[model samples]
Target chain A: MHPAGSLIIFTVLSGLGFGLLAFLGAGVVLPLGWEAFVWFAAGYALAGGGLLASVFHLGHPERALLAFTQWRTSWLSREAVLAVAALGMMAPYAAGSVFFAQPLPVFGAIAAVLCLATVIATSMIYATIRAVPRWHHWTTPAVFLAAALAGGALLAGQLRLAGGLFAVLAVALALHWQAGDRRWRDAESTPGSATGLGRIGRVRLFERPHTGANYITREMVHVVGRRHSAKLRLIALVGGAVLPAMLLALMPASLLAAGAALGLHLVGILAARWLFFAEAEHVVGLYYGRAAA
Target chain B: MTDLPETTDKKLGLVIDLDICVGCHACVTSCKEWNSQGYGAPLADADAYGPAPEGAFLNRVHSFEVTSEDGPPQLVHFPRSCLHCEDAPCVTVCPTGASHKRAEDGIVLVEESMCIGCGLCAWACPYGAREMDPAEQVMKKCTLCVDRIYNENLPPEDREPSCVRACPTGARHFGDLGDASSAVSQLVAARDGFDLMPEQGTKPVNKYLPPRERDRATAAPALEPVGEAGGFLGWLDRALSRL
Candidate 1:
């Protein structure tokens, strides 16, 4: 709820990384009967590498295996289970595709579904918490889906033969930008409403109980300036969406150009994720006198 | 291990009289003294008798002056700590079963050694009762002086918590709420006692009795002064009063 940059980056980055891997694995493993397995392998391996990098960000990565135990109640646990399942399906698919000269359709389809579900689960984990007003909205799921779609498109582009999927990526990027805009506006409106006071009323911080910054302030009341936020939004929209769309349309269907576009998109996604955290206000922000407008 | 039940047919809880509480913070000091020495880890204070002292105190009395349309300035002294809820969210959220509520007497407690400092229990509570001991990296909260209460060495009458004993105005009361005929239960039934943040759905067991209303019949109207000049005694009396 405090919108920690580390956590936001972890979520968005990992979503892209894992989503791409899953998509690549699905393409190669599933019986699309694609000409070359090398491209699929390369994309899947790259995405998997990103996924591995993201795990280091967790506070208790050692306890992640225990995450599966609470699947009955916690979506986090379900996500962990599905993540392992997807990876497991991919392992055999990768082996069969490269070495055995055959791809497993059933396993690939299951892995693809599981990967999508995992992303949804990850999104819901943050969105479900009632304490965070900005995240506890319908737009959260859409953001998650868009991130995955964009990541999948990047991976598809890396494979280049499946360049047509870039259209899907372009659409997803547009949707993400629109959703981000709406969420920013909604947050601005709602933050002002958090104090349970009207626009005309003036509230001042005459006294505070604690002299030193407490956990509440450190964890909940992170504020970002309007100018920087707007700039970041612009960067994300252009770099993540518009440019990628152009590259997908105009460029020779070469893996090198597609890779560049994907890299640029990832950079844009980083900016977007940063803004998502920096702009989104927590309900607890009211206590610190940071209610919206 | 079969041990004797701490309270035989008793579910002891607190009944706080809002009218009598002056918010002196004596109860908080007594609780810290009793609990830290007997049951749990010390309520460690940093920089005591120096520049800044920061520590965990088991009980805290907050002073707030509320002004209502129908009444004069109402000073509400809210003493908050752990409510020891019936549906304790802390226990349910504990991943390692470190926190639990007793089925015998309904006392919620934590096994400090077992706590991994995950901070989930703290999030579950709305009262801000649970605080993490930074030194040990474990969650700590009020134990209701469990060690002092059940000790056989102390007399039967001294078995109650230190906060209840140290209350100057007799604002604090502790007894079995489970027994219908008990004094605390009877007092709760007689007066309209309410729980703090009932909408939180924690179902806290501790009850606060509302401040009693005063009768208007005992009040007298002030007389209007006749002139600006007054006698020497009256003038001296007014000056002394101001001084």
Candidate 2:
């Protein structure tokens, strides 16, 4: 699993953006006039910017609209549709509150749910990949949802709620990592099974198919960042979850404290997200003789 | 449209014999040669002659050593490509309807015109079968040489996959595996050909024939010591010694 830069940005930014939108729609923070405008603008900018970043990774960005058609079977397609729906639904509610000072509670509630659903859809894009045993677990969605909720609470200035959610996020992250580390071996997929040569005897790669790297090796057989994973995990826990949780709990509620907490949390989450892809072992690696034992 | 059909009309695929493959990469070369010009996009190479060359290939041959208690280690040349599964995760995972299994022949293909090249299909495949063409920036895979297999323009004898036609040892066999009476199905029955990664539950159409057991006693018979030379040779030897 290659920890693609665009995808990392997309997942982290959009998760935070949608989390904020969810809180706003749920009436967690009620701001009027220009203040409402600022909040809604930040939400749209982060969410929209993240969505835009995703397109950069596509080979044919012009045909991305076609991606919306296969929602019935494709999580990526579902994500595209859900993102659009969430943003579209939130638009009117945001406009009414910001410009007209009319807080449409019912519309806001619906938009909030949609926002959360979009995050779920985004998480499912990775979660549904059975080829990557690490991500195929139920804990993938759990980790993602917890992060979004906690990050959203932080952005919405709900320090009390954010502190609780961060604790939950820490637990989810730990659970996901613990389970994910054992997923490949638990699946019982070895090189012998991958090549259907187990019955004969022990199978070991005698020769690789090519001297140079191919797309599959580049995309799925990544192992370069794995050496630093333990250190990165510590960073993710401290910066993304533990410190943020502690800061919100002990410190007085202030704009500066909240901003500093959000910055640290984002840095931690970025590192965690990087690990999410870098540490994941795709079953395809077995064929290339690159999978972890 | 990404949803798979209930079933395909014909389960057309390949059955490769590991024992016969010499790891020559002839099928690999032929597949690339035909597919580069035949299909939607030419298989592109990045820095082909540069320090670190990379390219998109539809098929590749990997060699592995199989060691058993009964015999010494033996090398098996394994050729890998798309299995074109009955339950292809690649097709269902396509965000665009570009990746789909044909209901008529069960050949999984990418409709390149509709492809957004998001690469989720490649990620879903456990076999590492599909490759993203670097230059074209679209997913490339073994189409089973669909252009040649069904092409009326080609000679009737040439109407098969390029790899099958190019195999020097006749190790690659292409036919309908769904039909019990088909030659490939019969061969599979006789040789105990098995699917790769059955637990993935992709229900692959393709099969692989395991390498036959090798004769451990490969040493040549010891030459008998000639106690005395044959009549002509003995006479010649004695006369030479007298001289």
Model 1 RMSD to the real structure? 7.9
> Each model's C-alpha lDDT?
0.62, 0.91
Summarize candidate 1's per-residue lDDT along B94-175 as a digit string, tens digits.
Answer: 5455677787788888777566555656655545577666455567787877876887999987888889989999999888
DockQ of each: 0.09, 0.73
CA shift of A262, model 2, Å: 0.9
Candidate 2 CAPRI-style tier: medium
Model 2 C-alpha lDDT per residue in residues A1-293, reported as the tens digit of each score: 99998889899999999999999988989887999999988889988899998887789999989999999999889988988988998888898899889989888899999999999998898898888999999999998899999999998889989999999999999999999988976887788888889899888888999988888988899989788999999999989999899999989988877988898899999999999999998888887776446
Best by TM-score: 2
Score chain B of each candidate by TM-score.
0.84, 0.89
lDDT of 2 by residue, B1-243 (tens): 788999888999999999899999999999989988988899889998899988999999999888888887989999999999999999998999999999999999999988988889999998999999889888889998899988999999899999999999999999999899999999999999999989888999999999998878777989998697868989999999999
Off by over 4 Å in 2: B218-243
TM-score of each: 0.68, 0.94
